[model samples]
Target: MFTREWLRAVVVVMFTLAPMSVGAEVPWQFADNTRYMAMGDSLVAGYGAIPATQGYAYLLYKEGVFDKIPNTLLSNVGLIGATSQDVLDKQVPLAIDPFVPTVITLTVGGNDLASILTGADPATVLGNFQANLTNIFFQLRTALPEAKIYVSNLYDIPEIPMATEIVLLFNGIVEGVASGFQVPVADVFSAFEGRKGLRLIQRNGADQYEVHPSNAGHRAIAKAFKAVIENN
Candidate 1:
């Protein structure tokens, strides 16, 4: 027969080796009535994805980044060609009023930089972008003090001249503004850096190129958002 002390020691070891509960490991819970709003440009609208449903915003909703599908209601107000000013003027109002989002993801400023391609002064474009982005964040934070907001930085396209440099500047602005409002930034720039087959425009053989993420790229962007949300 085993000694009482030996049996007690065995039980202690078994208890010590037991696995932790799944709930304890997870950082977030599936809270009820989570309203998620996505605001930005073409990427938010899923332009590059064939059906658009494959866009990062949709994927985040479908995959339950913020909460479970049953508990999460997603409203994507990301216009196809929306600039920072457009988002401030159009999307923010909707987010504040009827939607009253508990969670928001914004992706703007790319269209603001497009003005540079048309001979608009880079300094002027960047200044407007910075001001508009600052206002966008300020309004959202002020209006929805309890909501969690995440923003994405721009990715680099190697094909265009000085694209990398310009994108870096834009990402800097994104980071600076986001930091001011205590908003987390999804580092899409790093996700696409030196990566092949992320841009839909690159896959097409035509001389003209459009600056949008492919399906795989959307997935990458979703992953970036998910990472920040989970950590935050």
Candidate 2:
């Protein structure tokens, strides 16, 4: 029953069904393709993923989540410890100079509220975050005049103190700013609601967890953005 040809066929099938590699070609890698940039924090950087590409941005492109955008190149500009101000000051010009992105996804502001854990009061934190978000979107609008920007609002984490309040205020600011810029908001908050512990965020020490997405969580994120694209 174990013929050599049968074993060979099984091996071939397994290899064929294997996941695609990171560097694999998509549309033959042309220069004029849509420049897709991911801007914000560690979640956008694929922080917890085993391989960097296993994160949402790369998966979005690889899985053809953006069928609306063809011939694309992904530029990940997510910093590990970036805040909304960090993104405004640092990440803005990165998207502007040399290559103008055609589509952009941003995940910021959460770090601003997360700083509340560092002893900053929520009211002051919210004020500063809103100002930074406004400035960020304004600069992006001024620079890449034609890019389609998608912003993901903050989600609630049970462990983070005052997270629900922060979510309401922060997400409102995010949606408001995105609206001012005429950008669509991706519902990463709702998508991640009850699943943070199961597959989305990373597990930290006892009673503590990193707010970054796990690989499966990244896929869910990519799917959320994909749904936005599909709906629009």
Candidate 3:
């Protein structure tokens, strides 16, 4: 069994391990035309990946999994340790809206519960995260009226059972919110389930369930978003 504060400890470890320069460089393709804006936490930032650019946003842009509409620009402003509130209060207006992004992808709420999923009143944290998330969606719709908004539901962290439970609840909220706004959800949860080391995590062989992604995992995320984009 992991530590009592296992999930929180893992997240902090990941954040600490992430270098300042990890995600700073953008592929030439992204810099030239950033029609897509990725906003969220470490997952979106690709913290645990060997090269931060191996994260999902870059994969969606670079992975030739499915063809994108020509000239689609993708940019990721996802920050390590960012919570849903951070996205609402800080990252959104400053980074997202001004870009006039044609497509916006969000993956948030997990960090809001960090150590608190085991707390006495976890519902309170979930509620607050939901409110902040709803506001983010509403604001985005208002600011980028014509933009397509896609939300990535929480995916399970295999070593932590409580985290999976949290993923269920958090993803439910994501589904409900997306439904209300008539937005599409990229079910990154299902995509990551059952194949942690192989499909999702960075490690191969016996141990892949820890956290973060391998290059192939990032490509999977890219495909999930691509599916949403194509269907919607």
Whose lDDT is greatest here? 1
Tens digit of lDDT per residue, candidate 1, span 1-232? 2233443353343233223432232212323468788899999989888788899998998887888665665667788889998888877888777567899999898888888888999989998999999998888888999999999998998898888899998899889989999999999988988898899768758344588888999999999999999999
Instruction: For residue 101, give model 1's deviation from the true position in Å.
Output: 0.3
The lowest-lDDT stretch of 10 consecutive residues in candidate 3 is 1-10
- Candidate 3 runs further than 4 Å off: 1-34, 64-70, 95-97, 117-120, 198-210
Candidate 1: Cα lDDT at 203: 72
Candidate 2 residues 37-95, lDDT tens each?
A: 78888888777677976878768766756532344555667778889988887778777
- Clash pairs (backbone) in predicted model 3: 33-73, 35-73
lDDT of 3 by residue, 24-112 (tens): 53333233444666789887988666688778876765653333424454446688879898888766775443456767888877678
lDDT of 2: 0.72
CA lDDT, every model vs. true structure: 0.82, 0.72, 0.69
Name the lDDT of candidate 3. Answer: 0.69
Look at candidate 1 and give me any clashing residue pairs. none
Off by over 4 Å in 1: 1-32
Tell me how far the alpha carbon of residue 47 in candidate 2 is from the true structure, in angstroms, after superposition.
Answer: 1.2
Q: If ranked by TM-score, best first, what sequence of candidates would result?
A: 1, 2, 3
Backbone clashes, each candidate: 0, 0, 2
Measured by TM-score, the strongest candidate is 1
Is candidate 1 or 2 superior in lDDT?
1
